[model samples]
Target: ERLGEREGIASLPRPAGRLVWVHAASVGETMSALPVIRLLAGQGPVLLTTGTVTSARLAAERLPERAVHQFVPLDVPGWTRRFLDHWRPDAAVFLESEIWPNLLAACDARGIRRFLVNGRLSAASTRNWRRAPGTARTLLGGFAAIHAQS
Candidate 1:
Protein backbone atom coordinates (compact mmCIF):
# COMPACT_ATOMS: atom_id res chain seq x y z
CA GLU A 1 0.00 0.00 0.00
CA ARG A 2 1.10 3.56 -0.63
CA LEU A 3 2.30 5.34 2.47
CA GLY A 4 -0.35 8.03 2.19
CA GLU A 5 -3.30 5.69 1.67
CA ARG A 6 -5.95 4.80 4.24
CA GLU A 7 -7.02 1.40 2.91
CA GLY A 8 -6.22 -0.64 6.00
CA ILE A 9 -6.69 1.81 8.83
CA ALA A 10 -10.31 1.03 9.59
CA SER A 11 -9.74 -2.70 9.80
CA LEU A 12 -7.08 -2.63 12.49
CA PRO A 13 -8.42 -3.31 15.95
CA ARG A 14 -7.43 -0.86 18.64
CA PRO A 15 -6.45 -2.54 21.84
CA ALA A 16 -8.34 -1.66 24.99
CA GLY A 17 -6.88 0.79 27.47
CA ARG A 18 -4.55 3.76 27.11
CA LEU A 19 -2.58 3.83 23.87
CA VAL A 20 0.12 6.23 22.73
CA TRP A 21 0.28 7.03 19.02
CA VAL A 22 3.84 7.46 17.81
CA HIS A 23 4.33 8.42 14.14
CA ALA A 24 7.64 7.99 12.37
CA ALA A 25 7.80 8.38 8.57
CA SER A 26 10.69 6.04 7.94
CA VAL A 27 13.83 4.34 9.23
CA GLY A 28 15.58 7.37 10.65
CA GLU A 29 12.51 8.62 12.44
CA THR A 30 11.69 5.10 13.66
CA MET A 31 15.18 4.70 15.09
CA SER A 32 14.89 8.03 16.88
CA ALA A 33 11.51 7.12 18.34
CA LEU A 34 12.27 3.58 19.61
CA PRO A 35 13.59 4.56 23.02
CA VAL A 36 10.65 6.85 23.53
CA ILE A 37 8.27 4.17 22.23
CA ARG A 38 9.73 1.65 24.61
CA LEU A 39 9.32 4.04 27.50
CA LEU A 40 5.75 4.78 26.52
CA ALA A 41 5.08 1.02 26.22
CA GLY A 42 6.13 0.60 29.82
CA GLN A 43 3.31 2.91 30.77
CA GLY A 44 0.75 1.65 28.22
CA PRO A 45 0.32 0.19 24.77
CA VAL A 46 1.97 2.13 21.92
CA LEU A 47 0.72 2.39 18.35
CA LEU A 48 3.68 3.07 16.11
CA THR A 49 2.69 4.40 12.70
CA THR A 50 5.26 4.46 9.93
CA GLY A 51 5.07 5.25 6.22
CA THR A 52 7.01 2.38 4.71
CA VAL A 53 7.36 -1.40 4.75
CA THR A 54 11.02 -1.20 5.69
CA SER A 55 10.22 0.92 8.70
CA ALA A 56 7.35 -1.41 9.60
CA ARG A 57 9.70 -4.40 9.49
CA LEU A 58 12.20 -2.62 11.63
CA ALA A 59 9.52 -1.71 14.11
CA ALA A 60 8.24 -5.29 14.17
CA GLU A 61 11.75 -6.48 14.96
CA ARG A 62 12.58 -3.85 17.55
CA LEU A 63 9.35 -2.72 19.15
CA PRO A 64 9.03 -3.65 22.81
CA GLU A 65 6.17 -5.71 24.22
CA ARG A 66 2.83 -3.92 23.97
CA ALA A 67 4.10 -1.88 21.03
CA VAL A 68 2.66 -2.43 17.54
CA HIS A 69 3.05 -0.94 14.06
CA GLN A 70 0.47 0.41 11.66
CA PHE A 71 0.70 2.23 8.36
CA VAL A 72 -0.10 5.90 8.81
CA PRO A 73 -3.28 6.94 7.05
CA LEU A 74 -3.42 9.56 4.34
CA ASP A 75 -3.59 13.15 5.55
CA VAL A 76 -7.27 13.53 4.87
CA PRO A 77 -9.50 15.09 7.50
CA GLY A 78 -12.07 12.28 7.59
CA TRP A 79 -9.54 9.47 7.53
CA THR A 80 -7.46 11.07 10.24
CA ARG A 81 -10.57 11.54 12.28
CA ARG A 82 -11.51 7.90 11.79
CA PHE A 83 -8.04 6.79 12.77
CA LEU A 84 -8.16 8.87 15.94
CA ASP A 85 -11.72 7.89 16.75
CA HIS A 86 -10.91 4.21 16.57
CA TRP A 87 -7.63 4.28 18.46
CA ARG A 88 -8.37 7.05 20.92
CA PRO A 89 -4.79 7.44 21.92
CA ASP A 90 -4.08 9.07 25.25
CA ALA A 91 -1.19 10.99 23.72
CA ALA A 92 0.66 11.34 20.42
CA VAL A 93 4.35 11.71 19.59
CA PHE A 94 5.60 12.78 16.17
CA LEU A 95 9.19 11.97 15.39
CA GLU A 96 11.26 14.51 13.53
CA SER A 97 9.39 16.12 10.60
CA GLU A 98 6.26 13.97 10.53
CA ILE A 99 3.70 16.74 10.88
CA TRP A 100 0.32 16.19 9.24
CA PRO A 101 -2.11 19.09 9.35
CA ASN A 102 -5.27 16.97 9.21
CA LEU A 103 -3.99 14.50 11.77
CA LEU A 104 -2.94 17.24 14.16
CA ALA A 105 -6.28 18.96 13.79
CA ALA A 106 -8.12 15.76 14.62
CA CYS A 107 -5.89 15.24 17.63
CA ASP A 108 -6.64 18.77 18.83
CA ALA A 109 -10.37 18.31 18.27
CA ARG A 110 -10.22 15.17 20.38
CA GLY A 111 -8.23 16.88 23.16
CA ILE A 112 -5.33 14.50 22.75
CA ARG A 113 -1.95 15.58 24.07
CA ARG A 114 0.48 16.02 21.19
CA PHE A 115 4.28 16.19 21.26
CA LEU A 116 7.15 16.57 18.83
CA VAL A 117 10.56 15.04 19.33
CA ASN A 118 13.75 16.06 17.53
CA GLY A 119 11.77 18.31 15.24
CA ARG A 120 13.56 20.59 12.76
CA LEU A 121 12.56 22.88 9.92
CA SER A 122 14.98 23.97 7.23
CA ALA A 123 15.92 27.64 6.97
CA ALA A 124 13.97 28.00 3.76
CA SER A 125 10.97 26.29 5.26
CA THR A 126 11.27 28.50 8.34
CA ARG A 127 11.28 31.62 6.19
CA ASN A 128 8.21 30.36 4.32
CA TRP A 129 6.42 29.57 7.55
CA ARG A 130 7.30 33.07 8.79
CA ARG A 131 5.39 34.47 5.81
CA ALA A 132 2.22 32.97 7.28
CA PRO A 133 2.91 32.86 10.96
CA GLY A 134 -0.70 32.37 11.95
CA THR A 135 -1.09 29.33 9.74
CA ALA A 136 2.08 27.88 11.18
CA ARG A 137 0.84 28.44 14.68
CA THR A 138 -2.55 26.95 13.93
CA LEU A 139 -1.00 23.94 12.30
CA LEU A 140 1.51 23.46 15.12
CA GLY A 141 -0.39 24.66 18.14
CA GLY A 142 -1.74 21.24 19.03
CA PHE A 143 1.64 20.05 20.24
CA ALA A 144 1.80 20.24 24.05
CA ALA A 145 5.57 20.12 23.75
CA ILE A 146 8.03 20.46 20.88
CA HIS A 147 11.57 19.19 21.37
CA ALA A 148 13.32 20.67 18.34
CA GLN A 149 16.84 20.01 17.22
CA SER A 150 19.45 22.32 18.71
Candidate 2:
Protein backbone atom coordinates (compact mmCIF):
# COMPACT_ATOMS: atom_id res chain seq x y z
CA GLU A 1 0.00 0.00 0.00
CA ARG A 2 2.83 2.37 0.86
CA LEU A 3 4.62 1.52 -2.38
CA GLY A 4 1.47 2.19 -4.35
CA GLU A 5 0.95 5.47 -2.56
CA ARG A 6 4.56 6.47 -3.24
CA GLU A 7 4.79 5.51 -6.90
CA GLY A 8 1.21 5.26 -8.09
CA ILE A 9 0.26 8.69 -6.86
CA ALA A 10 3.44 10.53 -7.80
CA SER A 11 2.51 13.76 -9.54
CA LEU A 12 3.90 14.65 -12.92
CA PRO A 13 6.13 17.72 -12.97
CA ARG A 14 4.35 19.23 -15.91
CA PRO A 15 1.53 21.64 -15.21
CA ALA A 16 -1.90 20.10 -14.96
CA GLY A 17 -2.99 19.41 -18.49
CA ARG A 18 -4.81 16.78 -20.44
CA LEU A 19 -3.72 13.31 -19.33
CA VAL A 20 -4.05 10.31 -21.57
CA TRP A 21 -4.22 7.00 -19.78
CA VAL A 22 -3.14 4.22 -22.10
CA HIS A 23 -3.90 0.67 -20.93
CA ALA A 24 -2.06 -2.01 -22.84
CA ALA A 25 -2.53 -5.68 -22.07
CA SER A 26 1.05 -6.84 -22.66
CA VAL A 27 4.29 -6.20 -24.54
CA GLY A 28 2.67 -6.10 -27.94
CA GLU A 29 -0.08 -3.77 -26.82
CA THR A 30 2.47 -1.56 -25.10
CA MET A 31 4.59 -1.38 -28.25
CA SER A 32 1.59 -0.74 -30.43
CA ALA A 33 0.47 2.22 -28.31
CA LEU A 34 3.87 3.96 -28.50
CA PRO A 35 2.99 6.14 -31.45
CA VAL A 36 -0.24 7.30 -29.88
CA ILE A 37 1.52 7.94 -26.58
CA ARG A 38 4.15 10.05 -28.30
CA LEU A 39 1.53 12.14 -30.02
CA LEU A 40 -0.56 12.54 -26.88
CA ALA A 41 2.38 13.27 -24.54
CA GLY A 42 3.18 16.33 -26.57
CA GLN A 43 -0.14 17.70 -25.42
CA GLY A 44 0.12 16.50 -21.79
CA PRO A 45 1.12 13.72 -19.43
CA VAL A 46 0.74 10.09 -20.52
CA LEU A 47 0.31 7.24 -18.08
CA LEU A 48 0.94 3.86 -19.65
CA THR A 49 -0.35 0.83 -17.81
CA THR A 50 0.37 -2.76 -18.78
CA GLY A 51 -0.33 -6.09 -17.11
CA THR A 52 3.09 -7.69 -17.51
CA VAL A 53 6.54 -7.10 -15.99
CA THR A 54 8.12 -7.23 -19.44
CA SER A 55 5.76 -4.58 -20.81
CA ALA A 56 6.51 -2.31 -17.87
CA ARG A 57 10.25 -2.58 -18.56
CA LEU A 58 9.80 -2.12 -22.29
CA ALA A 59 7.63 0.99 -21.86
CA ALA A 60 10.21 2.46 -19.49
CA GLU A 61 12.74 2.23 -22.31
CA ARG A 62 10.44 3.23 -25.17
CA LEU A 63 7.70 5.62 -24.04
CA PRO A 64 8.12 9.36 -24.59
CA GLU A 65 9.52 12.01 -22.26
CA ARG A 66 6.35 12.93 -20.39
CA ALA A 67 5.13 9.33 -20.25
CA VAL A 68 5.19 7.13 -17.14
CA HIS A 69 4.68 3.39 -17.09
CA GLN A 70 3.35 1.03 -14.45
CA PHE A 71 1.94 -2.44 -14.06
CA VAL A 72 -1.85 -2.40 -14.03
CA PRO A 73 -3.38 -3.78 -10.85
CA LEU A 74 -5.44 -6.92 -11.04
CA ASP A 75 -9.01 -6.14 -12.07
CA VAL A 76 -10.47 -6.98 -8.71
CA PRO A 77 -12.92 -4.33 -7.49
CA GLY A 78 -10.97 -2.87 -4.58
CA TRP A 79 -7.61 -2.66 -6.32
CA THR A 80 -9.14 -1.07 -9.39
CA ARG A 81 -10.96 1.44 -7.24
CA ARG A 82 -7.68 2.48 -5.66
CA PHE A 83 -5.99 2.76 -9.04
CA LEU A 84 -8.78 4.90 -10.48
CA ASP A 85 -8.79 7.20 -7.51
CA HIS A 86 -5.07 7.87 -7.73
CA TRP A 87 -4.53 8.38 -11.45
CA ARG A 88 -7.77 10.19 -12.37
CA PRO A 89 -6.90 10.38 -16.01
CA ASP A 90 -8.77 12.69 -18.37
CA ALA A 91 -9.02 10.17 -21.15
CA ALA A 92 -8.23 6.48 -21.56
CA VAL A 93 -7.04 4.59 -24.63
CA PHE A 94 -7.04 0.83 -24.55
CA LEU A 95 -4.95 -0.98 -27.11
CA GLU A 96 -5.73 -4.15 -29.07
CA SER A 97 -8.88 -5.54 -27.54
CA GLU A 98 -8.04 -5.39 -23.82
CA ILE A 99 -11.53 -5.31 -22.36
CA TRP A 100 -11.26 -5.84 -18.61
CA PRO A 101 -14.82 -6.00 -17.31
CA ASN A 102 -14.25 -4.61 -13.85
CA LEU A 103 -11.87 -1.94 -15.05
CA LEU A 104 -14.18 -0.90 -17.85
CA ALA A 105 -17.13 -0.76 -15.52
CA ALA A 106 -15.19 1.40 -13.11
CA CYS A 107 -14.13 3.71 -15.89
CA ASP A 108 -17.68 3.98 -17.06
CA ALA A 109 -18.89 4.73 -13.57
CA ARG A 110 -16.30 7.46 -13.25
CA GLY A 111 -17.34 8.94 -16.61
CA ILE A 112 -13.82 8.47 -17.94
CA ARG A 113 -13.98 8.59 -21.71
CA ARG A 114 -12.50 5.42 -23.30
CA PHE A 115 -11.30 4.35 -26.71
CA LEU A 116 -10.23 0.99 -28.06
CA VAL A 117 -7.62 1.11 -30.80
CA ASN A 118 -6.45 -1.64 -33.12
CA GLY A 119 -9.14 -4.02 -32.02
CA ARG A 120 -10.41 -7.30 -33.36
CA LEU A 121 -12.57 -10.09 -32.02
CA SER A 122 -11.28 -13.40 -33.33
CA ALA A 123 -13.76 -16.04 -34.44
CA ALA A 124 -12.86 -18.29 -31.52
CA SER A 125 -13.17 -15.41 -29.09
CA THR A 126 -16.38 -14.25 -30.70
CA ARG A 127 -17.85 -17.68 -30.10
CA ASN A 128 -16.90 -17.43 -26.47
CA TRP A 129 -18.32 -13.95 -26.28
CA ARG A 130 -21.54 -15.21 -27.72
CA ARG A 131 -21.75 -17.81 -25.00
CA ALA A 132 -21.71 -15.09 -22.39
CA PRO A 133 -24.35 -12.93 -24.01
CA GLY A 134 -24.97 -10.61 -21.11
CA THR A 135 -21.29 -10.10 -20.37
CA ALA A 136 -20.45 -9.50 -24.02
CA ARG A 137 -23.19 -6.93 -24.45
CA THR A 138 -22.35 -5.24 -21.20
CA LEU A 139 -18.66 -5.05 -21.98
CA LEU A 140 -19.19 -4.04 -25.59
CA GLY A 141 -21.53 -1.24 -24.58
CA GLY A 142 -18.91 0.53 -22.47
CA PHE A 143 -16.42 1.38 -25.17
CA ALA A 144 -16.95 4.98 -26.17
CA ALA A 145 -15.02 4.57 -29.37
CA ILE A 146 -13.00 2.00 -31.34
CA HIS A 147 -10.30 2.18 -33.98
CA ALA A 148 -9.47 -0.79 -36.13
CA GLN A 149 -6.12 -1.32 -37.89
CA SER A 150 -7.64 -2.70 -41.05
- Number of the top candidate by lDDT? 1
Worst 10 residues of 1 by lDDT: 1-10
Q: Give the TM-score of candidate 2.
A: 0.86
lDDT of each: 0.85, 0.80
Runs of candidate 2 with Cα error greater than 4 angstroms are 1-15
Q: Which lDDT tens digits does candidate 1 get at residues 122-146?
A: 8888898899999799978778999
| Model 2 global lDDT (CA atoms, 0 to 1) | 0.80
Each prediction's TM-score versus the true structure:
0.91, 0.86
Number of the top-ranking candidate, with TM-score as the measure: 1
**Can you list the residue pairs that collide in candidate 1?**
none
RMSD of each: 2.0, 3.1
Error of 1 at 33 (Å): 0.7
Per candidate, the number of residue pairs that clash is: 0, 0
